[model samples]
Target: MQRLYARARRAWDRPLTAYYLVLGGSLLLTALGLVMVFSASQIEALQSGLPSTYFFQKQLVAAALGALLMLAASRMPVKLHRACAYPLLAASVFLLCLVQVPGIGHAVNGNQNWIQLGGPFQLQPSEFAKLGLVLWGADLLARKGEKRLLTQWKHMLVPLVPVAFMLLGLIMLGGDMGTAIILTAILFGLLWLLGAPTRLFATTLAVAATLGFLLIKSSPNRMARLGCLGATDPGPEDQCWQAVHGIYALASGGWFGSGLGASVEKWGQLPEPHTDFIFAVTGEELGLAGTLSVLALFAALGYAGIRVAGRTEDPFVRYAAGGVTTWITAQAVVNIGAVLGLLPIAGVPLPLFSYGGSALLPTMFAIGLLIAFARSDPAARAALDMRQPVFGRMRAGVRRKTMRRRAERPPSGER
Candidate 1:
């Protein structure tokens, strides 16, 4: 017990508060996600003539790989990452463009967004695009700060918003409103962190929101889904297949779940028992208790990510860390909320838990970046090694002068 306490104290002496929070939260969430994926995917898997552990097995592999990536990323030198930021960002953009090509890009659902690389591995350019933009934005913003220029904020939107829109346009062209929405959110968050003028942000946001609304309203499929949103009672099984089923699963679980592996909903009642709507499987199989547990896990992640942002001294670390957290946690909240019929039905995946290769890889790398910053912060180091600097000669000079003055002084009582 004493050893544990001492070790924990040593850990706290560093700026790793956020690092631990984000990394630990990510691991916890991944574990929980794996279990839920199995619970949720069983029915869908069975229906598709696959094994019960199919999704779980894949997710588990992804998690293991992600863990290694996280560690490698955390241990990587900060300068290397900074140096590679631009090129990585550019490559991600290029990939995003490639995914838009006819032969290269694979269509899923209605979105021609994924680039399938044979062997069950599908790459989503938008996923990499998100990370690239975050890294690129961080580097750009930091350089602006280094130059000690405030006016750069005005010109900042020029390249940034266009690049963001280009990514958004390409994603939208692929019919991925969810990815576009997420990209928009990330961009706005980055801009906010960059200290863009408030009035400009407000004006730009209104215009973009207006455009987003028009796009959604114009799409029949999106409009149909939007119609089901904000409903007091959803019928995902009827008009809203996913939502109604999710509600059923939640209601079935009641309190202490039907017990793990006891979910009937995974049998086929839920369209995507393991993927986007896995939360429903959790609610049905684990009940309200299970659902709450999952919620608590995410809450912990959000808190930890925020802690990391707060602990960092550099704006780049702070922005990148917090931005990644926002991308993941915010998306989770939106996904779960939409599933439970609390919000509109948008096809956003729950991070780390969702069965997508593209999302998992980038998310893992982002967590790695968070860990990297957390592991090597100078502020954290200074706090841990609180030894004052030694100035031997200067110290001797001051001490000798004090002694001489004292010796030369007349007795205090003489006056």
Candidate 2:
């Protein structure tokens, strides 16, 4: 346990600035989650004759445990993350495969993507897959960059794209479209940061957009959602009910919100209050002001990730940090967008803010990686070197003493 704690502290101690960024982001999100969960779940529990704070209590435990894991991960170096990437990727893939097995995996809302871990907590393998794929992709790209993929895409990217698609294909089998899209965004972001071929990325983006349209349109349930956007009367239990309720929650909040835990929509009117639609509850109880605050928090996270990526010279560190950062930020955007009715719902949870052990722990661990890379930066070392006043004074004194002795000495012949 001592060893474990030391390792985790290394990530935080690596760079004070990086540590602060992660700390701020983590604390803000956790605090915001606590508030929103309570606001969203209060009415939900009353409607169902359960404890009003049931969801909040569970989320608090998960967040606390997740923080512990994050600290442990932060102590590791980038080399450690790179070395473990492959094994982690393989493990996540295996778990995802297990989730597909009958009787082993549990089905929820038409998608059989969750595995019952024999507890109140269920494991979402795709969440782990997102983290694994990011690290693995980063490792691959770092190797390519080492071999000068900075100038050679044909040899590097051809191999890279397939691995990405393979992971996406496996995830899509669960019909987890939101996770797939988030993974794709991370992949593209990493590739872009690694300087992958521009034409390839743009072309792939176009193709992806087309495929996403086809996927959504193929399902009548999803198609109805798109059609209901313009319809005033979507009926009582139609496609628009969820989205319309979400919108009403936001509008009801007005500016300052209806005070904490006073949301009326969470009274079974809005669906998935503790899951994908958590953002709707935020808007409903905390109002537009609160929703924007959440957005700003994610914006800060993206900034930190970008800064870390830019600070590191190691390709592996850059890609891994950037990939993970992109993954979380992108997921946050998609979740918020879905709640705002700007996008069709695809059942993506709100990263740290959502009540899921799987998403929370892995995400916190990834942030730990970001801090590790940021702390190990070349500039940080230089700054530390400059701060050692004792060493600087010692060297300065030595130079002056030598100059004084030389001045007092006779010519070289006398010496």
Clash number for model 2? 4
Among all candidates shown, the one with the greatest lDDT: 2
lDDT of 1 at 408: 94
Cα lDDT of all candidates, in order? 0.78, 0.80
Candidate 2 lDDT by residue in tens digits, 1-415:
9999998878645555664676687779988887788777777777777788877888888888888878777788677888888998899889888887988888778877899978667888888888888888888877866776557657556766777787777787888888898988987887788775768778878887898788887878767766656344546676688877888888899997897878888888889897889988888778889888888888878877887887777888888878988898889888887777787776899988977778888898887787677667876756656778878899999999999998998998876
Against the correct fold, how does model 2 do in TM-score? 0.84
Over 4 Å off in model 2, which ranges?
Answer: 1-18, 46-50, 229-237, 381-415
User: Relative to the unseen true structure, what is the C-alpha lDDT of residue 255 in candidate 1, on a scale of 0 to 100?
Assistant: 87
Worst 10 residues of 1 by lDDT: 383-392
Measured with C-alpha atoms, the lDDT of residue 343 in candidate 1 is: 76
Candidate 1 lDDT over residue span 1-415, tens digit each: 9999999987755465655666777887788888777767766777778897887788888788888877888777767777877888788778878887888999988888889788777788888888888877777777777877647655677677887888788788888888788888888888776767888889889988998999988998888788786554545446676677777787788888898989887777777777778788778777887778778777767776667677767877877877887787778888899878887767778888777656787898888987777666776556445533445666888999999999999998995
- TM-score each candidate: 0.85, 0.84
